[model samples]
Target: MSKTFKFFIPCDKAHIVCDKAQYREASLWEKAKLITHLAFCKICRKYTKNNTKLTDKIKESQIQCLDRKDKAAMKKDFEKALKDYSN
Candidate 1:
Protein backbone atom coordinates (compact mmCIF):
# COMPACT_ATOMS: atom_id res chain seq x y z
CA MET A 1 0.00 0.00 0.00
CA SER A 2 1.90 3.00 -1.32
CA LYS A 3 1.03 6.51 -0.24
CA THR A 4 0.77 7.50 -3.89
CA PHE A 5 -2.10 5.08 -4.60
CA LYS A 6 -3.70 5.86 -1.21
CA PHE A 7 -4.57 2.22 -0.63
CA PHE A 8 -6.68 0.86 2.21
CA ILE A 9 -8.47 3.59 4.08
CA PRO A 10 -9.61 2.53 7.56
CA CYS A 11 -13.26 1.66 8.27
CA ASP A 12 -13.74 4.73 10.48
CA LYS A 13 -12.41 7.00 7.75
CA ALA A 14 -14.45 5.18 5.13
CA HIS A 15 -17.64 5.70 7.16
CA ILE A 16 -16.89 9.41 7.46
CA VAL A 17 -16.28 9.61 3.74
CA CYS A 18 -19.48 7.69 3.15
CA ASP A 19 -21.46 10.24 5.20
CA LYS A 20 -19.81 13.15 3.45
CA ALA A 21 -20.51 11.61 0.07
CA GLN A 22 -24.16 11.17 0.97
CA TYR A 23 -24.43 14.85 1.87
CA ARG A 24 -22.49 15.89 -1.25
CA GLU A 25 -19.82 17.28 1.02
CA ALA A 26 -17.03 14.86 0.13
CA SER A 27 -14.21 15.88 -2.23
CA LEU A 28 -13.79 14.14 -5.58
CA TRP A 29 -10.73 12.25 -4.35
CA GLU A 30 -12.52 11.16 -1.21
CA LYS A 31 -15.54 9.95 -3.18
CA ALA A 32 -13.27 8.06 -5.55
CA LYS A 33 -11.46 6.36 -2.72
CA LEU A 34 -14.72 5.53 -0.98
CA ILE A 35 -16.13 3.98 -4.14
CA THR A 36 -12.98 1.99 -4.63
CA HIS A 37 -13.05 0.82 -1.04
CA LEU A 38 -16.71 -0.17 -1.38
CA ALA A 39 -15.77 -2.44 -4.24
CA PHE A 40 -13.99 -4.80 -1.85
CA CYS A 41 -15.60 -3.97 1.50
CA LYS A 42 -18.99 -5.63 1.86
CA ILE A 43 -19.74 -4.01 5.24
CA CYS A 44 -19.13 -0.52 3.98
CA ARG A 45 -21.14 -1.19 0.85
CA LYS A 46 -24.12 -2.36 2.91
CA TYR A 47 -23.75 0.61 5.24
CA THR A 48 -23.77 3.01 2.31
CA LYS A 49 -26.77 1.27 0.79
CA ASN A 50 -28.72 1.37 4.07
CA ASN A 51 -27.82 5.00 4.63
CA THR A 52 -28.96 5.93 1.16
CA LYS A 53 -32.22 4.04 1.62
CA LEU A 54 -32.85 5.78 4.96
CA THR A 55 -32.20 9.16 3.43
CA ASP A 56 -34.55 8.43 0.56
CA LYS A 57 -37.26 7.23 2.91
CA ILE A 58 -36.94 10.35 5.03
CA LYS A 59 -37.18 12.52 1.93
CA GLU A 60 -40.25 10.64 0.74
CA SER A 61 -42.02 11.01 4.09
CA GLN A 62 -44.41 13.95 4.01
CA ILE A 63 -44.24 14.60 7.76
CA GLN A 64 -45.13 18.19 8.60
CA CYS A 65 -43.46 20.11 11.39
CA LEU A 66 -44.81 22.92 13.50
CA ASP A 67 -43.84 26.46 12.48
CA ARG A 68 -42.21 29.03 14.79
CA LYS A 69 -45.52 30.68 15.67
CA ASP A 70 -46.96 27.43 16.97
CA LYS A 71 -43.82 26.69 18.90
CA ALA A 72 -43.84 30.13 20.47
CA ALA A 73 -47.49 29.71 21.51
CA MET A 74 -46.74 26.36 23.09
CA LYS A 75 -43.79 27.84 24.94
CA LYS A 76 -45.93 30.66 26.22
CA ASP A 77 -48.61 28.25 27.41
CA PHE A 78 -46.06 26.10 29.17
CA GLU A 79 -44.52 29.10 30.87
CA LYS A 80 -47.91 30.35 32.03
CA ALA A 81 -48.83 26.94 33.42
CA LEU A 82 -45.50 26.70 35.22
CA LYS A 83 -45.93 30.16 36.73
CA ASP A 84 -49.46 29.36 37.90
CA TYR A 85 -48.30 26.08 39.43
CA SER A 86 -45.43 27.80 41.20
CA ASN A 87 -47.79 30.42 42.71
Candidate 2:
Protein backbone atom coordinates (compact mmCIF):
# COMPACT_ATOMS: atom_id res chain seq x y z
CA MET A 1 0.00 0.00 0.00
CA SER A 2 1.13 3.52 -0.70
CA LYS A 3 2.19 5.73 2.21
CA THR A 4 -0.20 8.54 1.42
CA PHE A 5 -3.18 6.19 1.08
CA LYS A 6 -2.69 4.30 4.33
CA PHE A 7 -6.10 5.09 5.77
CA PHE A 8 -7.47 1.56 5.84
CA ILE A 9 -6.16 -0.35 8.82
CA PRO A 10 -6.34 -4.03 9.75
CA CYS A 11 -8.94 -5.48 12.12
CA ASP A 12 -6.52 -5.76 15.04
CA LYS A 13 -5.34 -2.18 14.68
CA ALA A 14 -8.94 -1.06 14.19
CA HIS A 15 -9.93 -2.78 17.44
CA ILE A 16 -7.13 -1.04 19.30
CA VAL A 17 -8.14 2.27 17.79
CA CYS A 18 -11.73 1.63 18.77
CA ASP A 19 -10.75 0.90 22.36
CA LYS A 20 -8.52 3.95 22.50
CA ALA A 21 -11.33 6.05 21.08
CA GLN A 22 -13.65 4.75 23.77
CA TYR A 23 -11.15 5.99 26.39
CA ARG A 24 -10.51 9.22 24.47
CA GLU A 25 -6.91 8.20 23.93
CA ALA A 26 -6.72 7.67 20.15
CA SER A 27 -5.28 10.43 18.00
CA LEU A 28 -7.27 12.09 15.20
CA TRP A 29 -5.30 10.19 12.54
CA GLU A 30 -5.97 6.86 14.20
CA LYS A 31 -9.63 7.65 14.44
CA ALA A 32 -9.72 8.56 10.79
CA LYS A 33 -8.06 5.30 9.81
CA LEU A 34 -10.45 3.30 11.96
CA ILE A 35 -13.42 5.02 10.40
CA THR A 36 -12.16 4.21 6.95
CA HIS A 37 -11.66 0.59 7.93
CA LEU A 38 -15.15 0.42 9.37
CA ALA A 39 -16.61 1.79 6.16
CA PHE A 40 -15.88 -1.47 4.32
CA CYS A 41 -15.31 -4.09 7.02
CA LYS A 42 -18.61 -5.41 8.29
CA ILE A 43 -17.02 -7.51 11.02
CA CYS A 44 -15.05 -4.57 12.35
CA ARG A 45 -18.15 -2.42 12.19
CA LYS A 46 -19.99 -4.93 14.35
CA TYR A 47 -17.06 -5.16 16.71
CA THR A 48 -16.97 -1.40 17.05
CA LYS A 49 -20.72 -1.30 17.61
CA ASN A 50 -20.50 -3.91 20.35
CA ASN A 51 -17.56 -2.10 21.92
CA THR A 52 -19.48 1.17 21.95
CA LYS A 53 -22.49 -0.51 23.49
CA LEU A 54 -20.35 -2.14 26.17
CA THR A 55 -18.71 1.19 26.99
CA ASP A 56 -22.07 2.92 27.19
CA LYS A 57 -23.43 0.21 29.49
CA ILE A 58 -20.42 0.49 31.77
CA LYS A 59 -20.84 4.24 32.00
CA GLU A 60 -24.52 3.83 32.75
CA SER A 61 -23.85 1.24 35.47
CA GLN A 62 -21.45 3.57 37.34
CA ILE A 63 -19.79 0.66 39.09
CA GLN A 64 -17.63 1.26 42.14
CA CYS A 65 -14.60 -0.54 43.55
CA LEU A 66 -13.36 -1.11 47.10
CA ASP A 67 -10.85 1.43 48.34
CA ARG A 68 -7.25 0.47 49.10
CA LYS A 69 -7.90 0.13 52.83
CA ASP A 70 -10.91 -2.10 52.27
CA LYS A 71 -9.00 -4.22 49.78
CA ALA A 72 -6.09 -4.59 52.22
CA ALA A 73 -8.44 -5.64 55.00
CA MET A 74 -10.12 -8.17 52.74
CA LYS A 75 -6.77 -9.61 51.73
CA LYS A 76 -5.68 -9.82 55.37
CA ASP A 77 -8.87 -11.66 56.29
CA PHE A 78 -8.45 -14.06 53.39
CA GLU A 79 -4.87 -14.81 54.41
CA LYS A 80 -5.90 -15.47 57.99
CA ALA A 81 -8.61 -17.85 56.82
CA LEU A 82 -6.13 -19.68 54.58
CA LYS A 83 -3.67 -19.99 57.48
CA ASP A 84 -6.37 -21.41 59.71
CA TYR A 85 -7.47 -23.86 57.01
CA SER A 86 -3.92 -25.12 56.56
CA ASN A 87 -3.45 -25.85 60.28
For model 1, name the residue pairs that clash.
Answer: none
| Candidate 1 residue-wise lDDT, 1-87, digit = tens | 678567668788999999999899999989888988999899999999999999899889977999999999999999999999999
* Best-matching candidate per TM-score: 2
lDDT of 2 at 18: 96
Off by over 4 Å in 1: 82-87
Clashing pairs in 2: none
Cα distance off (Å), candidate 1, residue 23: 1.6
The local distance difference test score of model 2 is 0.93
Runs with alpha carbons beyond 4 Å of true place in candidate 2: none
**How many angstroms is residue 72 displaced in model 2 relative to the true structure, after the best TM-score fit?**
0.5
Clashes of 2: 0
